[model samples]
Target: MDNYSVKKLSKLAGVSVRTLHLYDKMGLLKPSVRTEARYRLYGEKELLRLQQILFYRELDFPLKEIGAILDDPAFDIVQALEGHKKALLARRERINTLVGTIEKTLVTLKNNTMLQVEDLYEGISPEKVQAWRTEAMAKWGKETVLEAEENLRSFSKEEMDGLKTELNDNITARLTALMHTDPKGPEVQELIARRYQIILRLTGGQIKMEKLEYFRKLGELYVEDNRYTPVNGMPSMELALFIKEATDHYVSEQKK
Candidate 1:
């Protein structure tokens, strides 16, 4: 049986070596064999197992949840793949709607045209946005709600949409920059610090490490709410996960 080293496997799988190590430590993946020197080696079986793992991760399953799902002896791999296919298709549809909305808005802006109120609400329901505001206020406090609402309401609907789109792009850019960075590296920690600073500014300094962790834990619940998750094409859960992971590393280092 052919076997690949961790480096080779990571390259083939398009994931970081650090991520692979974390997966192994989490028991989400394991090497098929170990050399006399204790080097991990992955064979065909490991590759298939990793494929399933990656698929679940891509579907946004938390590592723990994915571990439980894959560890069950009765787990039907084929059925899971079929289910995943359906989910992926649904996700694609949602992204398409969000992307189309953004594209249309961009077209309007480029032409210096003011969008109609109906067009402003394209791919979004005002009721749902209101519900999001309600939930956010309940969780974060009335003051936080009032601030966000006051700031957001100042923008016209088209302008608000543009702000959301720009924020999304900024998040993606920052995360992508951090993706290849070592979690323990000084550069990455600096980026994390910058992120924490922004968070603090937004929360008016009420969001420290303890409160931040609390918010992070409840984040998935917010994402479960359709009003939050399907906004602007990206799942808010995904953003939450990214922030959680980045901050987890930072906090761990800061304590030490």
Candidate 2:
């Protein structure tokens, strides 16, 4: 039977020898054979186990969890591989969409041309946008929602890009930074006030004092919607909640 020494296995597996030793220490993986010289050697069975460990690692499974799963008597290698394939395919689809969005953004930048509404919201699904629009209309009335959408559409590509950049770099950055701070603090409230102004601008200054509640509701939607939870490529439910709290605080202050 063919066997591999620790050094050989490390080279074959593209993992460091120290890593293999650590895995052995952790009882996560162990060589199948120990020679008279106390040298560790891995056989075919150990190779297969190492493959399984790497597969689990690729899926971002915790080392302890992977060890538990692999050591489970009911664990089926074939089923695990099949599940991994499905997850990888889904991840690939999302990556492709983000790539397309980036390409469109690049083209708009290179040509200095206006982007269509769809292009502006490139990676977001039209169905999702429509669903949000429907919900907005139901809550705020058709005229309010349509007017907001029209106002957004009226912007040139450069203006639209600038607005997105400001949201990401200014508003989102500040909100994310203050995630650990008190949401009702002066700094957070100031940021929330700026965010409210930006929203009003997006709505062509249509938002009035009476419609301020809409801004607070919009903050809630940021937490409730998975799409809005990710800002500037980072996902943080905490940040979304922080924004919602700050908006609520801002609105409460307005009432006083």
Candidate 3:
């Protein structure tokens, strides 16, 4: 029968001899035979076992868990291989997204432009993006969501950065400063108007009739979604709700 010594198996498997020794010590993998000279040798069965071990390792399985899984009497090689294939495909998909994001970033840098918010989230799954769009459409209508997306995509990187800075630094900072004040006070109302203006700037003044309602919904999102709550290094649910209340009052007054 063909066999490989520790050194040979290490070279063939691309695993370190020390790692193989450690596996042996842990009783995770054992040599098929020990030569008279006290050298460990692995036969075909051991090689196949090592391949399984490597596959599990690639999936980030703990060595103990891998050993337990492999040692399970009900374990099926075909099922395990199918699971590995599924995991590898998912990983490849994420890698492809990251690669695309990198390419876009490179182009943006070459053109001296800024990246869009969606660009920052390029590595997120498309399913998640679709889910967000679906939720927004349900609340704000499809036309509003599509228009917002189009408006966001139309901006250059520098323009997006300026808008983001205004929202983060100016609006958020001012809102946080008024957290203890009345949500419907004149000062807070003015800041809410400024917030609406920033959104209009982001949408290039195309918000028109949807401006008040859009800002109101955005404020609700800031309060409801932790993803949108944090700004300028402050992550406070209370602060977000306060902004939502202020925008709600502003929208109500504007309607009269």
Across 7-94, the per-residue lDDT of candidate 3 in tens digits comes to 8888989999999999998988999888899789899988889998998898776798789878887867577668877978999999
Mark the 10 consecutive residues where model 2 has the least summed lDDT: 233-242
RMSD of each: 27.8, 20.7, 18.6
Kindly list the per-residue Cα lDDT of model 1 for residues 1-256, writing each as its tens digit. 6478999999888888898789888888888788899888898887888888888888776788678787998878678668878988999999999999999787666434322322323456778756755666666566744554333233444544454465456643554455456434555444344444444332234457664554444333433342222323532222333344445555776689
Model 2 steric clash total: 0
Candidate 3: stretches off by over 4 Å: 75-157, 160-256
1-256: candidate 2 lDDT, tens digit per residue: 4379889899999999999999999999988878899888898889889998998898876798789788898877677668868978999999999999998877667444332445534566789756755765676567755444455565555655666677778877777666556654667555555666555554455556655555555654553352333646321112233334445566786789
C-alpha RMSD (angstroms) for model 3? 18.6
**Could you tell me the TM-score of candidate 3?**
0.35
Q: Which runs in model 1 stand beyond 4 Å of their true positions?
A: 1-4, 11-15, 32-38, 54-66, 76-86, 110-256
CA lDDT of 86 in candidate 1? 92
Q: lDDT for every model?
A: 0.58, 0.65, 0.66
Instruction: Tell me which residue pairs clash in candidate 3.
Output: 114-157
Q: What is the lDDT of residue 34 in candidate 3?
A: 81
